[model samples]
Target chain A: MPIRVKLDERMREKGMSLTELADRVGLTLANLSILKTGKAKAVRFSTLEAICKALECKPGDLLDFDEE
Target chain B: MKQSSLSLRVLKLVLTVCWWGSVIMAVLVPLALVYAASSSGNPKSDWEFSYTGYASGIDTSSLSAVDRDGREGRVEFNEGTWVQVFYPIETSAGRVKLVLLIAVVSGVVLAFFLVFIKQLKDILDTVSEGDPFVEVNAGRVRLIGVLLIVGTFGQALLRLVVSGYADSSLRTTGFQLDGNFEMNFMQLIAGVSVLVLSEVFRLGTKMREEQELTV
Candidate 1:
């Protein structure tokens, strides 16, 4: 299973880096990297909300379900 | 950074030494006895004769006569033979007693060590279960140490008595005082080491408790 994360596209469109997003969301770079790479088993709702708010995007804009 | 407790480590060391020492003795004592028995020739053939009748019962009238010098004499039966009979001397009884004493003392020492090891393992288990504040009984360790010391000393004394008896009865009894003394000394040292390590473990437990309280 793969969770297609559009973090790279969102960050590019917003002219922000992963470090900047991690700082905004009060998360570590490693955790943010896991989420961006779709390596996370599941993201907490609070963490997802924080990421969406920091990215100024909807959850649908950040996540996509793809069979792997 | 969790390390094993000092008492537990010492207990393991003592048990290992005790087990190995017993194994070596069990092998060596029988070998020594076999070597001693084999070197003295065939004891069965040399010591199986029984004295029956004396030479006075022999009939001299029917025997052939042989004369030498100016005297004539009749030859009687001459079947005298020298045999060496090995018997359990008085000293062997004392040695048996000493061996019994050593066995009893070793049993007591082993029992004490077992109990101490079990108690130490229990304490370690409790610590591993995240109960650092659990009360440890130092008295148990102390009691076991005392018992071990007493048992070891008793074994040493018994060995000394056996050696003394052997010296008096068996003329060629080769007794090595060094080995027995060293074993006894090591046993004493191990007991004392356990006691000291238990004290150190108690201190470590107290420090851990204090840290937890401050946290």
Candidate 2:
């Protein structure tokens, strides 16, 4: 939970919608929604690679560690 | 792929029947006792507490046995073991006590059995639905395990109390009432096993949730 997902900010910067990113990354919209909403328990490396490649960004750009 | 299992369905049916049966018994047992007590005009000799007792002294010398050869012979006993005695309730108060004892014992047993069956049915329902990793199922299993352990010990204590009550009231010269109270290792083991299983379920639920939420 401390690892915050900045997917919304990254997606906004890329000018892409969740459905578009899901289609590009080969992920379901529901799963993308979970990541965007910071509810995902884990992000697989392959999924991260696909999302990063689709969005043309690093994993660090979409993820942040917030110390509680 | 949530394919329905026929065996699970049959087991659910059996559990349903058992649940209803326990429910019926919970309602009927005390009623039956009350009816028996009320209907018998002279209930003193009719009602009795059946208990096992140890008899002392040398009564085996006079004991006779009939073999299959139709020859009667004296039987020798090595050790004076337990003897089943149906001690009659001679007084109205005693009969009332006996009825109350029966009612309480049956109530406890049926109550535990009902809850146990209900919990089991709930777990089975989850299993049948192909979602046995739910967290609630773990709680249910834990509850059943605790119930089993508690019920076993509680029944033993109740038996002891009833036997003590009988011992205090029944003033027979030769018979000493034995409560037949013993620790049930099997039920305890079963309860502990279920508790362990509940832990396993907890872990499974956690793992499942983690897997589901992983993106």
RMSD of each: 22.7, 3.3
DockQ of each: 0.01, 0.94
Candidate 2 scores a C-alpha RMSD against the true structure in Å of 3.3
Docking class of 2: high
What CAPRI class is candidate 1?
incorrect
Residues A1-68, candidate 1: write the lDDT tens digits.
Answer: 46677789999999999999999999888888877776666667788798889888998998888987
Judge candidate 2 at residue A34 and give its lDDT: 95
Q: Estimate every model's Cα lDDT from 0 to 1.
A: 0.60, 0.81
Q: Residue B12's C-alpha lDDT in candidate 2?
A: 86
Across B1-215, the per-residue lDDT of candidate 2 in tens digits comes to 46477988799889999999888888788789988777545743466667644443445555788899999997765654555557666777777777887787677778778888989998887887788779999899899889988987986776666566555556555434544565688999998999998999899999999999999
- Evaluated against the true structure, the overall lDDT of model 2 is 0.81
TM-score for the first chain in candidate 2 comes to 0.95
How many Å off is the CA of B69 in candidate 2?
9.9
